[model samples]
Target: MTQAPGDVVLIGGGHTHIQVMTAFGRRPEPGLRLVLISDQTHAPYSGMLPGHLAGLYRRDEMLIDLAALAEATGTTLILARATGLDLARRQVLCDGRAPVDYHLASIDVGIIPDLSGIAGADRDGLAVKPIGSFLARCDAILGAAVDEGRLRDVAVVGNGAAGVELAFALAARLRARAQASPPARITLIGSGPVVATLNAGVRRHIHRALDRHGIARRDGVRIVAVEAGAVVTATNERIAADTVLISTRARPPRWLGETGLELSQDGSVATAPTLLAMGREDVFAVGDCATILEHSREKAGVFAVRQGPVLARNIRRRWRGEELERHRPQTAYLVILMTGDGRAIAGRGAWLAAEGRLVWWLKDWIDRRFMARFQTAI
Candidate 1:
């Protein structure tokens, strides 16, 4: 069969892009060639990352082999980082490689931690991003501590889901360690209540969980600077810590703004309901890299997963000269967040929330099922 003459390029092996890869691999578009460009061979599943951090899952369990997925989908995998775009020429310039030309392109490159402005943060603190690297560093840190019988104080900065989860995971891992050293002091620092986006009831339960784990809470404290062995707060309070993990506000890569795509104030590509970059139907963006301008949903993995099929269908539709479908992002979705141990918190909005080991079991089951799909080709 003569393959599609033009190329459908996918940048970044994030959740949504992986889904598209799988779908296209199963029933590929007649003539369109599929290509995937990513710097990492395996894409970490964020849903199970907290569990991995907490030692509940092995590293391989939470990672999707992007290389294998690309092979299964008959995609040309390019192991290179996309540096920028030439919209006029419709080419994606990559580092150390020739530009990738495409009739249509979709970007799902997730955001990175914004530690540029913070003093000493880039040097002293570790940002919980580029998960692979962070995990490697964490393994080294914990492994050395376990071998040396040292207890290190850990401070997690960020009140969001990522921050709260990391704090809990660190506490859980430290508590479970066989070392007899005094339980590692874990502190969670946030400008507001932890997991503030969740229901108030859920937030309170999380606070109680912190207490149960003996993790200190410093709410309403803005970290102004990170110094050696401590973090300085805006209130002139210096919190002592040997390790700092940053899970604060995620910022889009600087190159996204250079793509000539419409971007929100925070630097994510602005896209229409069709998931197409505004003013350009040939270009699309999804996952944490793109902002749904109309819905303005929170940057969560659930929406990204939900957007996968829509993005896939729309990309094909655009090639077929058909009207693209609008993606209706759900306003309210269930939240079952890991609490760093074998338990979880399940809740909806402010009115609905609960905690228990059962929730953890449910979360575990769901996460495992999600990962199981990628174990084989679609």
Candidate 2:
């Protein structure tokens, strides 16, 4: 069998890229080679993240194995970080390997937590955007709590969905552990209301969950700096905390800025209707790493996964010199949030919240079904 030249080179094993891999696996395009380059072998599904943190699912169960996915899809898997891109040359520059020339490239490298401007946060606080790094630190924190006989005060600095979910998960996990030992104090601080982007009903449901867990919510509070034993807010309010969890707004990886591609003010790669990088048809991007021009929304994995089929089709179309397809995202999506217990809240648009263990079970069933698609095939 002759190895044809590559057609599409995808950087990052994000949800969209994984979907592309699955599509190619099930129905491969002849003469169009697919290649996937990713830093992590297993890509964690963001939707199941809160559940995983709350001990509802194991790490392995929540991850999509990129190596296995590539194998199943008959795609070349390159284990490396994409450092930069040469738009003119149409090549992806990786950390340690030779440049991969591509007919078309799609970036789904996801965003990183912005801690550069926050004082002492880079060194003192735990930035929990990159799941791989956070998991390692979580193990260490859990171990220390068990051995030291000290009830560490954990302070979460973001009040968004990610932060709220994380706070709930941490509070539940800590309280469970504390039932057998000393209790750890959990505080959730934010400059704005937690889950402010969500609808009113969803916000209320999340607040109720936080209240039920005894997770302190400090709204209108901003962290000015992070220190060893405390976090100083913007108003010079020093809060005593042993561990700080940073889940603030996500920023694109710095490497994207150096790629010479058109970028939004926030540093996300700019993309066209077809998800291709602006002014560069050969390049494409999606997931949290991209800022789509036609329609903009929050950086959610649901959109990334939804964009996968369109991206895959567009890539194939570009390879075949066919017309590209435009992706139209739905105005609203059903948000199912886990309460870190056996219950969940379901909200759609301005609809009232429906809370019950049955909702959690339904959400679990849906998430598990979605995850099963990427598992290693027998």
**Which structure among the candidates has the greatest TM-score?**
1
Show where candidate 2 strays beyond 4 Å. Answer: 1-5
Worst 10 residues of 2 by lDDT: 1-10
Candidate 1 achieves a global lDDT of: 0.87
TM-score of 2: 0.96
- In model 1, the Cα lDDT at residue 345 comes to 87
lDDT of 2 by residue, 1-378 (tens): 223655689998988888888888888888878898888888888888888888888889898888888888888998998899987788899998999988778999899988865799988898987988888887797658656866568899998878888887887677666652557778999998887777888887888888888888899998989998899988888998888889997799999999889998789998887998889878899999998877887887778878988998898788777889998777788878888889988887777578889999998998998888889572
Give per-model CA RMSD. Answer: 1.8, 2.2
Model 1, backbone clash pairs (residues 3+ apart or across chains), number: 2
lDDT score at residue 55, model 2, on the 0-100 scale: 82
CA-lDDT, candidates in order = 0.87, 0.85
lDDT of 1 by residue, 1-378 (tens): 123588988989999988888888889888898899999899899998889988899999999999898898898999999998899999998999999998999999999989865689988888888788888887887678667766467899997888888888887788778473766788999988788788889988888888988889988899989998899998878998888889988888899998889998789999999999999968899999998899998889899989999999998888888899999899888888788767898888659898999999999998898888777857
Return the lDDT, model 1, position 351: 90
